[model samples]
Target chain A: MATVAGHPETPLIEPVDRGEGLGHSIVRALSHAPLTILLAFIGVMWLVPTLGLFFTSLLPASVISSEGWWTIFSTPSNATLENYRNIFSDEAITSALLTTVWISIGSTILPIIVAALAAYAFAWMDFPGRDWLFIGVIAMIVVPIQMALIPIFSLYDRVHLFDTLAGLILFHTAFGLPLAIFLLRNFFVGIPGELLEAARIDGASEIRIFTRLILPLSWPAIASLAIFQFLWTWNDLIVALSLARSTQPITVAIFTQLRQFGANIEIIAPAAFLSLTIPLVVFFAFQRYFVQGLLAGSVK
Target chain B: MTDSSITAEPPNQGAPPTADEAGADPGRRRRFLVALGFLAPALVFLGVWIVYPTVYTVVRSFYDRSGDAFVGLDNYGTLFTTDILLTAIRNNAIWVLVVPAVVTAIGLVFGVLTERIRWSVAFKTAVFMPMAISMFAAGVIWHIMYTQDPSQGTINAAVRVVSDAVNPPGVLSGAAPSGDDLRGSAAQGYRLQGELKAGEVAHLGLTRIPASEVKDGVQAVVPATVEGGITGVVWRDFKPGGGGTAGEVEDGEVGIPGVTLRLTDASGAEVATATSGADGVFTFPDVGDASYRLGIASETFRESYGGVSWLGPRLITPAIIIAYIWVWAGFAMVVIAAGLAAIPRDVLEAARTDGATEWQVFRRVTAPLLAPVLSVVFITMIINVLKVFDIVLSVAPPSVQDDANVIALAMWRTSFGGVNDFGLGSAIAVFLFLLVIPVLLLNVRRFRREA
Candidate 1:
């Protein structure tokens, strides 16, 4: 995910002015139509490779190699539900789904709760080193996560958090917080001061105001951040591979299933589809707020 | 309910009370503790998981593999010379150089192009769908698509269809001469030893190709040689039961078409070259009476229309980057699209009315304006590519995984798994962190400038 500045400077793209004669302008309009078709064509071309695999994954592996995947269009019965069924019947795959769900939920929720507090402080509270501390937190965004894995992994062993779901949850939370705070604090600061002022006048404690006012009103921001964290932790492989060992999450599970020659489509296609499809569904469903979270980072 | 409840005041708008002035020592201490309390969990996690470990890595990098004896900078030095690490660095340079610029450029185009289209939402959603897939899964998909076998890999299959149409299929590997009767070296293919007359036909047989694999269905036809012409059959020499003589043409052996025959003079100087036909026979007609030795050129062994080896040690990094670009270009597009949406139309119209063409407007107006979004996307991609691990791990075959390794993956494999060389891994980690500083600094500088 990246961000766009919402600065007052207007974006620089526009349809060309066409004040010429009607014949010339008709030429422009017809030209515009082709351009539209060209863009759409490029979009579909961009999509076809992934689309090809998706389609192939639906067919039996026997059918996949014999004929072109596109041949299935003419011969519709070639597709099968076997791969998706195999994912559930297989013991390793089914449990990986559970692990991924548990980790995604834990990793998303804890950081938001923790970062909400930190964000509120950064947004509103007066404290020594607030700017520097907030800057320090956000600066960690640039540090490659590899820098922390080994030492912290050993540290986790000493603390007995290694190879545990809780360890990875904490790991995601640590890594997730800085970006969450940066995003959430930006949102929290933009809330009208008068609304908070009124609550303060009503004798609301800091905790009460945070829960009653900030938390309730900041749902969109929180939701956006939650979806992002969920997708990230859900799709993560390196962390889960390096840490947690009892059972695999889908990311690592699919990775481990890979053979030396190539992937097993029966497992990878459906498994990947299952892994990719869920968050995409989540993303599209909550997309209104999702873009808000995305834009928050750079708009400031 | 109470005056005490009202004591936790918001920042007073009129004249904010200084920590010491209006609030006595106890009150100031209370505010400090509350702020610390709010920050505690975040601080604790960041400390244990990120800060402390980062500091630990830096310290450990100076020590030996067990992190016991101090061997200052030795790990770092090892990183420079280690083949995999150096390759990782070089590959990352490729990633840094190629992926971001290409992704940003494509995204910039998509952002601009989609602006003119009506189905922008559907288009963007389609493009950005790959972001939902993990790099591991993406690796699986792309790996399948890049399969070397035409039956399995979509890319190679398409290439096969196109190349088969446009060019003749020269046998790619698996076909070679099988006998001591094949008298030529690897540099030159075999020739008939006992042949006396130039007008006679001599047969040259190869053994590796199955009869069914010959390019055309027609049977091999040996033609009578013209004056000074040398004609021979290059067919697979072996038969299934070992009944066929060594280096002699046997049934069920396929002809190796497209083998070049070089006829050299007795002085071993000038020679003529002629390629075989579909039936493994070639003719070289000449004028002079000097006897010439016939030899097979090396090109016959090569696979005709063979697709490039995308997963080979050299190309694996670029292949993975193509996958990475497919996954992220849409993301860049969406971010830039948002930036594009922020642009005011008036200036664009003004430029248009002032006689600037569409290309000029795009280059001068849209591009310059979208630089911030582009830079942000580029920097983020730089950050991402530096830490790329999953695809390299998942996509590269275990045999060549070392060849395709990135810094992050190298760090993992070096320290743990089997190596247990935490010192070297930490050094790599530290090396990666240093590599990231320039982008981080660039991002920080941009943020400060904007702030």
Candidate 2:
């Protein structure tokens, strides 16, 4: 037995050797049983409400009205894929799904592109009033979307962008740029100055250096930024709700169903689940980068 | 000229160049141009979408609803005076007061507790899953959870089960007085029309209860005479085919069990209380042979234990705040967990080795170390909750939306949601911006210090 004798007074037990049998592991686990149980209990509290909603979505309208969704545990045969099938077949839901995809992609890509260029400028290239300009972007990060709604509503009306997907995407992109630039600039600043200096010494133009040296090196930051922007845009309701009426995203579409006294819950359930699925998939797939971006974006 | 000067510079860039040799003015101008080229698109966006509109909204706030006439301070006056907007401000105050502190506390607990557990990964994944979903989906989830009907709502169903287990509902929930002998309504407790003395037998009749609702093992019977007290037979008065005499308990009718009868004096002060047994016979024994009114307790006839109206006007703000916490607590936890991971473990071990208990170590060592991260989470949540629009719109029914309204929702409602008053909306928008200025300054100062 490898006796790990570092801190005898520590309440939490240390991990035993890998070669130790399952019995040892079980004993170690049981040593911290109270904390483990508490964590598991909290975790279940967080997950049960979502699980309940998910089970409710699989139930039929009549069954939903007659009994609690927990009853499905006793009668597992009551579950069906009918709600999913119905929502997929509905024109409004399908179109909103398509709109959400388009908006998310446009909103994500445009901000990353614009913010990357600007971040490069702020980080490496020297310009007049550069610090002040970057601070201005930082300040706008806290400007409430409410501040922009009235004036921009009028602007969109004049420019004929009202109720268009392009208009909504533009709005998301603009609000997204401040944080994107801030995060990417912080990351871009950390890249070795010698690399950019060497490229400049090689007679590479600014655009050439930006494309070949800067962007290739900043993919981690860009990846994280992309995921954050995509999630934000996909989950947005205020921007889409204000700017785009005819081209409503899945969020707004589901919101419409909710407004009708929770009518057509069969539709709202599956549609909300469907709307949530894409972001979840993207999030889990790139969770590492997403967390990295979040930590870097928030803390100094 | 600046473009040409960049090409004219010597290739000896690594060696420190003198001021004249560095192409001082033109090279500087060229660098400025190149930086401008890179920054142009972002600057244009920031100006148009944020800067221009922010300034315009401030100016528009001073104007009238149509934005033509200059009605300085009137819209601001209306914001402080209007009932709906005032409610919105109050609700926003409630949100700011409650949400950030609760979220930070929960996050700190989750982050610290999961550090030593093997199942920490799975627990965190479960908690953080809500952050990935849109607020609309969360609203939908909570909307169903908060439904008034126990059968349809999971929360209500759970509440009903617990309440029913603790204190069961009475059998007279839907039962009402059948004859003219009972005189009061359910809001006021029902009473006998005439006073009764000890040893008198009062016949109490109830109707409108379904047969299926009556509890098992209860049987209707005539009350036996009891000494020194009023005796009553509370029974279902209606017969199945309506052939029984009015106000009389027939063979088919059953006893209404669990009905509480109150004995009150002529001055309406309650003297004694007694509950009916399985045979519907209730006796208020030990009465002092004084004349008293025989009455039914209002609680006996009250509605069955339905769950709370979580989304009603009184609870809507708190209910929506809970929903907001559900979505954002994971974000806070993830961030705080990262901060927790960054804390040096030796300090904790050292404290433990120095005879500090776990609670003392946590209170003195851990909490101070986690303060910066906690403040970051708190500030971020304050900003997030200040602009809470979507969850309010999605979860609250339209009838009570005004009751649950916040400042951002008020801004949207005033400008876009049918009211179309641009000036007041602009005033609200500016007020919201002003509210965020302090937090924004704090964040900027932190960033500047870090840079």
Which prediction has the highest TM-score against the true structure? 2
- Which residues of candidate 1, in runs, are more than 4 Å off? A1-34, A63-68, A259-263, A298-300, B1-22, B170-304, B442-451
Candidate 1 lDDT over B348-383, as tens digits, reads 777777765666676777777777668777777878
Going through the candidates in order, their DockQ values are 0.34, 0.33
The runs of at least 3 residues in candidate 2 whose Cα sits more than 4 Å from the true structure, single-residue gaps closed, are: A1-34, A65-67, A74-78, B1-21, B24-27, B176-207, B215-302
Question: In candidate 2, how many Å is residue A33 off?
Answer: 4.4
For candidate 2 chain B, the 10 contiguous residues with the lowest summed lDDT are B1-10
Q: For candidate 2, lDDT tens digit of each residue in B1-451?
A: 0011100112222112212345678788887798789999998999999999999999999999988899999999999999999999999999999999999999987887778777788988999989888877888889888888887687788888898778776555566788988988776778898999888888898888888766552667878777887888888887778788878867877777778899999888989999887768888887876789888888786665687899899999888888889988888899888867755688777665665555556666667666667877888888988988888988898989999999999999999899999999999999999999997787666555444
* lDDT at residue A216 of model 1 (Cα atoms): 95
Give the fraction of reference interface contacts each candidate recovers: 0.42, 0.55
Best by lDDT: 2
TM-score, candidate number 2: 0.83
